[model samples]
Target: MMRDEAPIHAGKSGLRQILRVATTADHRVLDALGTKFDLASRSGYAAFLSAHASLIPALENLLDKGPVPPRWPQRRRAGALAEDLAALGRTLPEPADVPDLASPAQRIGALYVLEGSRLGGAILLRHVTTAQPDAPVAFLDHRSGERCWATFVEWLDGLDCGSDEQRAAIEGARLTFAAFAAQFRAWLATIA
Candidate 1:
C-alpha cells in the first residue's frame, strides 16, 4: 500500500492514487526515521509515541474545529495516544502547531495522511505485540472492527477532484508529512 515507485502513468486520477504518488517521498523519509528506533523497548516506544504526540493530536484537534469529516470522531486518536503514553508513565507532549487546514479539500487531504497512517500502525502493532507483549498499544490498536481505511478510501474515491482540488489535497498531505518529519527530528535530537 505504501508504494515508493514513481507516480503512476496510467489513466489513474483517483484521489487515492494521486495522494499515494504525491506522498511517496515523504513516506520514504519518515520510514527511514521510523526504523531507527526499537519499538519493543519501553524507552524506544516512549520516544516513538512522543514523536507522534507532536503531530497527531494537533491535527486531530484542528479537524475537530470544522464540520466533522467522515468518521472523524471515531478516528481521533489523541485520547488513545494519551492512554499509551500514560501507560508508560509519560505524558503526551504539548501538541505542536499544525498548519492551517481551512479548506475542505485540505482537510480531506490531511485525512488521507491520517488514515494512511493506520496501515503503518498495524505493522508497528505487530512488532510491539510479538516482541514486547505488554507494551500499551492503544494508539495502534484502534478501530478493531470498523473498516476505517476502506470507508475512507471509498469516500475519497467518491470525490470529483479537478486539477485545483488535486493540488490542494496534495499540498495538505505534504504539509502534514513535513510537520511529522520536523517533529520526529526534534524528538530524536532530545533523546540523542
Candidate 2:
C-alpha cells in the first residue's frame, strides 16, 4: 500500500505516522520561507544560509544534550553553512537561542525538522547550482540523498515512546518549525 493509504499500527512505529500527519503544515512553512528569499542571487542565497545557520546549530546542540538513538546519524549542516557564508564573503550571523528541549522525545521531534530538510535541500541545491555555479553549496548538498531520509524514517518508526512522549515529539517539531519561520521573518526584516 502507498504511504498515505497504509494503516498506522500502534506501538513503536507511530512517530512516522505523526510526522506524516504533520507534513502538510510543515510544507506551508517551507513554502512561505521559500517565497521570502530570492534563490537566484548570491546575497539571497547567503541570506538563506544565514537564516538557517541561526537555527540548525541551536537545534543540533539541543539534540546533543540528550541521549540520541545509537543508530541515528548525527548529521550537522551548520558548519557547512558557515563555510558557505565565508566563501560567499558574507559574515556569519550570531546563532539564535532556541528554547530548551529537555527530553529525548522532544529532541527527536526537533531533529525531524532538521533531518527532513535534506529532502528539500536536494531541490535547493539544484537551484543554487543553476543560479550560482561558483557559490559554495555544501550546506544544501546531501550526498546520500533519499537514503538518509529513509534511514531516519526507519529509526523513527522503531521508536518505543509512550503517548506523552509522542505528544512531546509532535510539539517539539511544531515549535522548531515555528522558530524557523520566526527567524526567517526577522532576517527578511533586516534585509528589507
Error of 2 at 12 (Å): 8.7
TM-score of each: 0.89, 0.86
Name the candidate that leads on lDDT.
Answer: 1
Model 2 agreement with the true structure over 38-63: per-residue lDDT tens digits: 88887778788888988887677778
Count of clashes, each model: 0, 0
Runs in model 1 with CA error above 4 Å?
A: 1-13, 65-69
Each model's RMSD to truth, in Å? 4.3, 4.8
lDDT of candidates 1 onward, in order:
0.82, 0.76
The most accurate candidate by TM-score is 1
lDDT of 1: 0.82
Query: In candidate 2, which residue ranges exceed 4 Å CA deviation?
Result: 1-13, 69-74
The local lDDT score (0 to 100) that residue 99 gets in candidate 2 is 59
